[model samples]
Target: MALILSQLFISLILSLFFSLTLLPHATTSKANSSSEYSITSIFNVTAANHKTSQILSFKPFHNQEEFPQTFSSSSSFKLKLYPAASLYNTHHQHKNYYSLDLNASLNPGITTGTSNFLVQIGVGGPPQKFYMIFDLQTDFTWLQCQPCIKCYDQPDSIFDPSQSSSYTLLSCETKHCNLLPNSSCSDDGYCRYNITYKDGTNTEGVLINETVSFESSGWVDRVSLGCSNKNQGPFVGSDGTFGLGRGSLSFPSRINASSMSYCLVESKDGYSSSTLEFNSPPCSGSVKAKLLQNPKAENLYYVGLKGIKVGGEKIDVPNSTFTIDPYGNGGMIVSSSSLITMLENDTYNVVRDAFVAKTQHLERLKAFLQFDTCYNLSSNNTVELPILEFEVNDGKSWLLPKESYLYAVDKNGTFCFAFAPSKGSFSILGTLQQYGTRVTFDLVNSFVYLHTLCCN
Candidate 1:
């Protein structure tokens, strides 16, 4: 039977969103073991399959160069998280702006828009805790501050820079101010910025330098960030945005950390807060992959996706189907913001057919537009799912746990394959497939480490 798609898939294709955030500046676990980085913070992922207005087309600013190009690159950011860095500093001195969409409920019961995942962070000296979206795509970080000319209605008090003794304004001549995308000198001589988003959300305020802190790492001083005196847009839940991009201005790069990772906790209908570790070490039996760059979308994370293996058997598919184009087209992308893992049609079909065959015994259900393979297995039935092996060109293969690939749609035994086919040439290894695994984006070495994380 020819498969058809569903509203969920339609939404995945049409939906838009924003963000990324700080990885690790330090490290800490529940057992309180001192591991790699000095400072580490654990945040939560408000996992949900909420529906909203469909985003018709992906607006490319290079697009995802944040979601590292719209959630088809994380929709768009109010404080746009573009990858352009300060001219001089490719590492930390680059001119850039990034965003973090803290996953707080947006007018619950109203299907206007839906968001998932948020991380808790501390900003300023004697750091104030703020819950922000944990987006790993963009590089700019910001917070809604007081003395507001205009501000979004957030549950928490807007941060008052005046209350933080460590707050210091950036001068127009300062290297940090010079690095901002829309920074200018105010009449009063302080550096000012006006960040505009795709949906017309804008945050304008003074560029300031303050001490930002994390859990075990204590305080990192002179962190350049935005203190939005005037804020507007769909970002109405948390205090502000956080950067987790490749630009020098990104919190991870600024700290000069070698590596970091975020293990997305699976809490399918509800929010299960997870952890974000900076300078994280590789887990035992961890696999590695070289992090490639897409010239067409340089700001996003591009990796060499070799191919896939089903139940220890290699799926026969051409390498070019998963390759990065010389012109930088049609490469595979892995993003935490994107909800579905989209693959190029040719490759997806092969994987889909094999997956369906493996679970052929279970009673099949009508296809959800968003997912092609689905089954209505009884609660008491025991079916074995194929062990999905994702291969990276860097001589490593990452096995996706069952929870990462299969999703339960309802209280009954209705379940579906979480992977989807891309309408475009590229493929995205999205957050849905990333759950229950601890993966690290190694900044210094330009490699990624993947291993199963079963946090107690």
Candidate 2:
């Protein structure tokens, strides 16, 4: 994720603070300290073109926290949050994934006073209709609202901080005051949050605490949120956001499981699977709590990368190609879903060129990208070139592919895509291409381990 302007402001302040404090020197000396974080290998598998496979497996946790010091205390470090649309496939028995409404026409569909699509924020099943950017890079859930606003249209229950009875705001002098990360504060002691997207969209308001009720027997109280008087764009449809990042500051303060797995896909394609799992051997019980690895400030978690083989020929890219910076700063967050989509398109582009050069049709390869949309397979009227077969991890290893798995489809069709949701860029592997694969994300390690498993 690329750093958003807002995050950049904070990074700069942090950078300056650490630079003068000899933090660079301190960093070297602290490498051996208990503060050092490490990620254990969970799972990995080989992957191939247009195929579903399982790569890695690891134990899932109920919750995890990120260290705030990960951000350098540099005044010049400007990081911003980019909001992105994500796909979540909520099926446990069947393969499923969320779908995105790609610019049906590439020309932002014209809408009435109401935007063509409505973004909603909900804790449980029912969606609270609101304008929001379904961000893939964010894990914390929050919303913009008044103490008592028009929540009658919400599909899910809405939180009325006024009635929360236990709702409390963090004092300007409270330890949680830093939760806002960015934004200004009001004289009334309300925390102000201002977020702007790369698309030039912006939202700002006073931060408040509230209750979020989810059907999973999990209810989060005292969650931080932005109560906006003038929320612009499609975000005004709901009360707040449902963050799915690795942080602990989102709505639904508590969950049955320590980890939250989300897969953002095209809304039109539906879900691929209902449940996602992270399985790894448990850490030694005697291991000190301090030994638990924390996510690196600049690192993000991602699945495996077996390497790419284009047209029976392997293409070499640095391991960094698969590494993601989940921090929503200047990093990446690629998923199997998006990889499928991208590889398909790229393969087709290559075949189109091959046919043109030979002045004859090259036999089309029997292949499928990861997406589940029918449009992807339909030539209907558009006769696009055939897709190319690229092996991930050189066919030796793979990310086990399931019918439905949650993943970030490739963002922006770029190979080295960076997903900075706070800036409104969510890098996902779309279903159009990513269909099968057991993928694992190591938030602590800057590597994607993949082990491909065949689709049943």
Candidate 3:
């Protein structure tokens, strides 16, 4: 049972997930072919003539102090999102994926916190590598195969499938075994699935279709995945959970990528290292937004905010508070495993009363869990504070500094407003409001850009 990023738990929202090692899909040739889009992997880098994207270099999950940082006494701090945060603990129920965030707070109590995004792929027909948990909200990609009965603990070894040679399984009349998500039809015909991971964890698995090479590029073949064999949750060091949703089996609609970029870099105690670019993005265009498409939370990525700013004023809010209803509930999302930012509660009390009327002599404190506003600052005060925008609806706005809405709680030395409110009306910008920034994600041209980092 794996697939997560309930990195948003904060009692407000932080969701994160993992619990994998999926693999089982085999058919070879064509991944939306035209010659597998002109072969190339390991991030080969190319743009003008296209067909050369296969960039890779993002691997940081060396435990990082285990995550899940929640406290209360020293004055207050909490990051619980599960039944009390969980990113590991599997050696009987099986858990060696101390990777992605179960609570994603390396230690937000102050310094080293929030991190999730590991990469390294290659599966079958002789390829092996693994690592996973890239998740743009998952679509279908799995691993943890081998002659097992109940697997787990996969840092390496376990993908065997008779040493690749283009492994296979799909059976039940292909079409990627009916796009598993609660599928069925086994008895030995294969295609069986079960899924279920918004944190309640679940997995039955069978759906196969291997051969997805990538050290940087080329080796498409067969693709479709999810060969769990057995799984639980937490997925520590990782072994599966890749998908970069939009459906059609994800991975940006099977490598069609008209766009893709990532850069969160800010490291130095969180020890950072990031990269996830495809199809040119060291910089480009610089402004764009309009991704909203929540088929009832299908992989998550909505937008259309339109309200926010402090320095220049403009806390008008209510454009339906960002609109999205039709039952999918008011929009807002950009969570790479959410770290903070959650608005929506009367638009966060009218943007926290317009930032407490511009810091009225700073002092407030008391609502711990979803942070009402929190405050402390004083030491050599100069305090100009103000300049915090978010307005997105063309007239453009995404700025927000002051360490992205504050947050220092040096064990109660105080300083937080890392932003939080939503009990659940949908709103989650997280990733600490996307630190250094630089997020592309064009999803074949439906929009999504957000700048700042140039590829750090």
lDDT of candidate 1 vs native?
Answer: 0.57
Off by over 4 Å in 2: 1-134, 147-158, 179-181, 236-239, 246-258, 263-306, 310-313, 316-320, 323-332, 335-396, 399-428, 436-456
Q: Write the per-residue lDDT of candidate 2 for residues 1-456, one digit (tens) a residue.
A: 345443333222211111110011122122211222121111111111111111111111111111231112211111111112112112222211112223211111011111111233232112233333333344334554454333223222344445435455655555445655565667987666665543443456566555433322233445565555444444432334544344544331223223322222221122122123222312221111111112442112333333433223344544433334443322223422122233223333343344233322222222212222211211211122211222233233221122221121211110111111121222234332333322333333333333222122
lDDT of 3 by residue, 1-456 (tens): 121222122212122221111121232232211111221111111120011011012122333232112211211111111111222333334433323343332111111112355566677756776667666656677767766677767555568788877777787767766665568888987777877665555556687777665553354667778887777656645676777666677765565666667765544222344566666543553556687776566556676657777655678776766778676777786665555677777888888788778777667776554466777653413333554677666566666423556554332234556776666766777765675677776766677777653545
Candidates arranged by lDDT, highest first: 1, 3, 2
Global lDDT scores for all candidate models: 0.57, 0.29, 0.54
How would you encode candidate 1's per-residue C-alpha lDDT over 112-220 as one tens digit per residue?
Answer: 1212455555566556666565555566678888788888765345787767878998889988787777889999899998877554577899988887655443456
- Model 3 weakest lDDT span, ten residues long: 47-56
Clashes of 1: 46
- In model 3, which runs have C-alpha deviations exceeding 4 angstroms? 1-84, 90-134, 148-168, 171-224, 228-244, 250-302, 315-333, 338-357, 360-409, 416-428, 431-456
1 or 3, greater by TM-score: 1
The superposed Cα distance between candidate 2 and the true structure at residue 179, in angstroms, equals 4.2
RMSD of each: 13.7, 17.2, 22.3
For model 2, the run of ten residues with the poorest summed lDDT: 16-25
